[model samples]
Target: MPGYSPPVSMLPSALQTRVDAVEDPVVKQLIKDIVAFYDTETPEANAQDIIKDAEVYRGLGMILPERRRADIAIKQDRLVVIVKDKVIAQGDWEMYDLVACLPVPDRPKPTWNVVIANSTGKDPASSIVLTLTDVAADKFIENAKPVSIRQALLDSLRPYVKEVYDEPVLHVTVHQGSREGVLSFLHRYIIFGYRKPLTILPLSQISNLSYTVVTRLTFNIVVVLTSGEKHEFSMISHDSYEAINQWVTDRYLEDLSLAEERRAKKQRAGPSELEAAAEEASQLPEAEDDSDEEEAEFSEESDSESGGEEEEESDNAGSEAEESDS
Candidate 1:
């Protein structure tokens, strides 16, 4: 029977020997097709290319084994996941809700997974999970420093800078726990959490912010709100504490200057034109009410006088009648 055959020159000597030994025509044809499919060179044919072809096989009602391998890279300001030069996913540091390296069952190496919260949905089911290989995981951790990561997040919120006093951010801290929580920053405000803000405290609302030295090596930060509420955060590094203090001092000076400028401007302008107009309009109603009360009192007095004259006329007529009768 005529059957598909691979070029003997294309295979190694051992493979070519085996193909020659196979007498069954159908079996030989199947082996040829498999070898050709793998060896056929397409554009940048790599593992991803293999998967794409495998998908095509499935579409044609053929069963093919599924395989996946992706590389994650920190490219400048964004984290990118690539599969054979194709970007499968890319996101800024702000897109991530949580990132950690975790071990998989029966796998010797740990896998890195990023949990991304959906902007439109708040439920856990709406979140997306991305897995990265070992090499990519190392690069991610190296670049994901508190300062750099926070800077990326702040860059996205540049529009709110003016309202937030546009003050420089001094320090950033990540909570210490098995499940690492969101990143917190000391900016014009103490903003915490990811995509959705978990806690936001205006600088003005903070009555006192200090750190207690727990030991020579570590410390805990204490934040006192204006309402006498205190929040204590432990496991702060010495360097972070120093940065926080410097930021607090700088913010204090900035606040003082801003207050003085506002006071001077108010004095120079006196009362606003709108304010003066509103005050004059308020007095008009009072004047109108007083005039109405005076008119009512005058009418009451006139009625009393008219009634007295009528009574006096009636008494005079009765006396005249009595005299005439006599």
Candidate 2:
């Protein structure tokens, strides 16, 4: 019944106390086993790397499809998820995929989503989704973006700014069909949040998009999808409406330009190269499903003092906008 105590000892004082309170010997050992998996693995070293060199982007977030909230940090190429100050999940850039700029639940301003797969298991059962504000999210995206494609993406997006475009999200209510939700948009995606899970719409799917000022206080956005599906949203924001509308027009045009680049590239590659590329793409493993979450609320969260309750260390925590559920 003694099993392994080494892993338990390796845990920080606060988490060790939690493990000590467990009454059952088997339960205690099982918890240690999970810890051993992390300690003996690469994540401990990853954390050490953060401590020594890299800066960390840390925040709180929920796991998708499972809906478990935890403390998350990203440093260098590593990301860790902690509950009650105990690390429950951890992985590096190479082990799992990363996605950024996805929509998020109504919580705080300058919010964005950072999703990385839970990499402890071989089969990849779940993902850690950190809903981060701009400071943390920006740091994450800077590292997560692949060097190879970063230049290509900028080249594809027309009128690309040397610096990424910035717009402070003004939380406003929008209606879709029978549902009313908070509307948020980025350069590439639309996220609608309310009582249900956040529904995301990617700009790439839209064939045409238009916005109209209905009254002095309200406006409507009409979207036509590449599939010919049409959707509309009505939102009221006195301060940010025109700015948001203009931003959307600019981004939508950029999206179309990027799409055209893809076509041009394919044409230059010829039929045989397209077939070969399509076949190669098909062999890649599929990403995990991220919808079907419950209600999530955000709060104004500032960074905790450097390191733990006492120590200072680099906290760590980007990728792309996910496609629409509608």
- The models' CA-based lDDT, in order, is 0.47, 0.51
- Which regions of candidate 1 are displaced past 4 Å? 1-168, 176-179, 195-197, 257-326
Where does candidate 2 stray beyond 4 Å?
A: 1-69, 73-80, 84-171, 177-180, 194-196, 211-217, 229-231, 238-240, 256-326
The CA root-mean-square deviation of candidate 2, after full C-alpha superposition on the true structure, stands at: 39.0
Q: What is the Å distance of residue 105 in model 1 from its true position?
A: 27
Candidate 2 lDDT, 124-212, residue by residue in tens: 33344444444423333235444322222222221322223233243457787778866666556554543344454566666777776
For model 1, state the Cα shift of residue 268 in Å. 30
Which residue pairs collide in model 1, if any? Answer: none
lDDT of 1 by residue, 62-89 (tens): 0001123544344333333344554334
Instruction: Give candidate 1's whole-model lDDT.
Output: 0.47
TM-score of each: 0.29, 0.37
